[model samples]
Target: MTQTWLITGASSGLGTALALAALRAGHKVLATARNPTKAAQENPQIEELGGIWISLDVTSPDTAKHVTDAITTAGGTIDVVVNNAGYSLLGSIEDMSENEIETQFSTNVYGPVRILKGILPFMRAQRSGTVVNISSSAGVDGAPSCAMYAGSKFAVEGMSESLSKELQPFGIRVILVEPGYFRTKFFAAFVAPAAGLTEDYVGTPVEAALKAIKAKDGSQEGDPVKAAQRILEVVTSRGLGAGTEGFLRVPLGQDCYNRFQTKIDTLQANLTKMKEIAHSTGFDS
Candidate 1:
């Protein structure tokens, strides 16, 4: 069955890769970017493969309306919506300015919220759809110099979890894709603190993390093409995702798997250790 997919931030990275993958799989793609002209210029294959580029800036207050308009223009039915437009703001908590943090959340967190508000009505009425939110490994485990970025992704994870349950009865599926260090312009595009690294962070983990990130910019282990293909397969229940239904989260890359495992282990350990203490908070019934 051919489905229509609406993908944000399709100008580059995993968004562009997913658009191409879906197009090759015979699906109609509504690829959106902040600048469709430039996006088209950068990714001519999308147009060649029958993908339509729509202009959408997720950070804008009118994002929900724009999404609704785009859906209406695309024949009023959307099967898959990928909220993939986001960028990282890398810095220490104190180093980041208020505007920087707000911008990060606006793009990474609120962007998806607006998209959901626009598409939920249609999906509910249709009683079928998939919402794929692209999170990050940092979302599962925080790291130095990534407080703001991790916070944004954590918000995504939390919302997606609740949304999955909320939409289950409506036959709508929500998936959070937590990818780790994919070989995209993601690393290269990260914004640093506007105030620059303060002397307090000169020799701290923040500096080390920044250096490590720079070193890994173009040498990330994960492949965006393969990741995109996997996402498509998961949504359509083909390839590796065959027979895998009722899965809420898809953690991409070995790094992501490792991080998730670590988090699970830590949580289990804490639960066991604090069982009595946790129970003590409740009053006798």
Candidate 2:
């Protein structure tokens, strides 16, 4: 069955790829970007694949209203919403400014949340929907120089996990796609260091991380289109939409897979070691 999708950040990378994939899957999509014209120009493939463009800056106070209006004007309730618009404002906690951090949160965290707020009433009226939050491995595992980004992702992950349960009775599902790295203009002229900070930590972990990112930029192992396809597959899986068929956290990319598996393994081992104590505290009988 074809459904309508409202995908934010559909201008590039995973968002753009997901937009194309969804369209190819026979779904109509309302793709949003900061500048819809530039987005369409930058990624002509999306237009070629048949996607309608809309203006959406995640940092805007009008996000909820904007999305609400777009959905209303399009004459369709959003069947799915992919909160894929976010960027890494990489900086040390001490190095980042209040304005920078707030700006990051506004887009990376609050924007999506507001979008959810706007769409919830519609989804509730329909009594069914899916929300895919484009999170990051940083949500679960942290690498150096990702303090702020991780915080934002972690915020998204926490909400998705809980909302998956909260909306379960309503037949709505929330999924988090934690992807590691891919070639995207997230760092292009579109973003910048949040001012008031000097990049003097050059030879340190942050610097090393930046070097590593550029080193592997275009050569990232995971294909964005394939990743987007996988998301659609998951979304359409019969029993998974209610969050009963499987896990809430779907880590994409070899980089993410390994890190997530390691974290889970370590957590399991720790739980096993504490099993006896945990059980002991559970029952006095």
**Of the candidates shown, which would achieve the greatest lDDT relative to the real structure?**
1
Best by TM-score: 1
TM-score per prediction, in order, is 0.98, 0.87
Summed over model 2, clashes come to: 0
**Span of ten consecutive residues with least summed lDDT in model 1:** 241-250
Cα lDDT computed for each candidate against the true fold: 0.94, 0.82
Query: What lDDT score is found at residue 24 in candidate 2?
Result: 87
**For candidate 1, lDDT tens digit of each residue in 1-285?**
999999999999999999999999999999999899999999999999999999998999998899899899999999999999999999878988898899999999999999998999999999999999999999889999999999999999999999999999999999889999899999999999888988989899999999999999999999999999999989999999887678988999998899889999999999999999988997789
Across residues 201-267, which tens digit of lDDT does each residue of candidate 2 receive?
7678977876676677666678887788878888887433344346677788888988989989999
Q: List the residue pairs that clash in candidate 1.
A: none
